[model samples]
Target: MSTETVNPVTGKIDEQALVTKANRQDLRFAIIGFVVLVVVMATLFALVLDFMIDGVPRISGEFLTNYPSRRPEQAGILSAWVGTTLVMSATAMLAIPIGVAAGVYLEEYAPKNWLTDIIEINVTNLAGVPSIIYGLLALGLFVQIFRLGQTILVAGMTLALLILPIIIVATREALRSIPLETREAAFGLGADKWQAVWMYLLPAGRPGILTGVIVGMSRAIGETAPIITIGALTFIAFLPPAPLQDTFPFVNFDWLNSPYTVMPIQMFNWISRPQAGFHVAAAATGVILLSMTLLMNGLAIYIRYRIRRSSR
Candidate 1:
């Protein structure tokens, strides 16, 4: 009995040696990948830590309540943060339903054809298109043609367009991840396509869908070029009209048409100033923006976990 795994035709060791060689290659690839990941993560961590060290002490009660001013110490992000919130609310409202519906239709309902293929290709390409392009488009379509002005509504619509491709791609990919067997099982249970998708597939894919939504929003929140191009004020002294009115309906849509500025633009304004105090203010704004992004991602993770646990 021979111990070696020999190829009888070649009369040499073959299977065993090949298997050992392949395993070694795999191990080497994994080790290299891990090292690269660690290096990238460490670099990012260092940058964020530096920001926190410089900015954390500068954040004070007044900083959150006051508006921008020539005196950096007196200037605050009150208007910037409020504008960011309202614009993000509008972006999410517009982007989520439209993007998700487009994705679902293309993935499950649309027939496989050249038109669908072209649509999918364009969508994937759009995800990689520069953010400035969306800004330009918004300037033409929303600002000039539609006469929406460079208001909060226009900014929101611009960002919604920028992130639409991301949500759509994420949605289609998430749905595609569902096992064919799962779909068959749903059909076997006498559920129609729409019923199965709504009742089962969508639920199963919710976590991934939510993850995509959060990621798109995170990108949208940090975007400056589109907002700047859309003429977001660099130094807004006043806040938009309050969404909650004191009388009548109690809720008003007046803020949508009001001029606005977001955190990134505010930070940019500070950074471009010659004063060191303004630089410090910029760093502080960065910290707040980063915190907001992390909070959104954390909330998404928590929601996804709850959904998965409940399903199980």
Candidate 2:
């Protein structure tokens, strides 16, 4: 058999030489990949070590509960963390359902027409738009027009808009991954459209949907520009309203209108301050933020694995 290449200098087919060359190419690619992996691992290791050295000492109960103060030693992240949690919770609640519903409609129900084409194009375009633009849009529509003010509700809603396109795209892609025969089989079994979607499609698509949601949320948690543009206070000394009330109506929404700050905002404020202690505190806060993001990603992976196993 002839080899893949002939020697240009000798003008002869050399099968052994060609095989050696192919092996070398493969080896070189593998070596490059290994180097890249090593570099990434080293970077993460360095970051973790730095945080531990500078931040661990400051990670006390007092630091967790104390409010922001002019003194670096007295400042804490209570309001910042609480605000982050509340805002993220609200964002997830608003974005996930709406985004998934829109995705389902686009993928399973919408007609293949110019209108749908326009919508698809817009959705894709929206995903790439600068986050600050979404902030501006939220500022104009939610804050200025609707008069929501600079509050947790407005911030959560803004972040929801930021991640909506991502979730929708992920949902559509997940739905597409299901084999067409599966849907056909469901229909053959006398399943209606809603039944087919809810019973067969959504469950199979859950892994991808969950992956998208967590990834989008990671981005939301790190966002600072949009939140700042919407006037989130960097120094939120007071906690927002409580979820429960002692009065007649048990639930309270007053927190939605209160001022808030998130981890990123808190870190920003600390890093910008003229104090070494504050800088260390910022590093500690980063460790917390990183931990949260990693935890979310791990959960997504676990859930996805379970879904795949169940499907199998």
User: Which structure among the candidates has the greatest TM-score?
Assistant: 2
TM-score of every candidate: 0.83, 0.87
How far residue 78's Cα lies from its native spot in candidate 2, in Å, is 0.6
lDDT of every model, 2 decimals: 0.90, 0.90
Assess the local accuracy of residue 49 in candidate 1 as a C-alpha lDDT between 0 and 100: 95
lDDT of 1 by residue, 1-312 (tens): 344557777887787777887798899999999999999999989988988997888899999999999998998999999999999999999999999888889989989999999998999899889999899999889988999998999999999999999889878877887888888999999999999899888888888788889988998999999888888988888989999988999999999999999999999999999999999999999999989888887887786677567657
Q: How many backbone clashes does every candidate have?
A: 0, 0
Give candidate 2's whole-model lDDT.
Answer: 0.90
Model 2, 1-312: lDDT tens digits are 344578767888887788888899999999999999999999989987888888888889998999888888898999999999999988999999999999999999999899999999999999999999989998899889999899999999999999999899989988998999989989999999889999999988988998889988988998888998898898878899897899979998888888899999999889998889899889888888888887887887887788678769
lDDT of 1 at 241: 90
Model 2 lDDT at residue 71: 89
Query: Which stretches in model 1 have alpha-carbon errors above 4 Å?
Result: 1-38, 181-191, 298-312
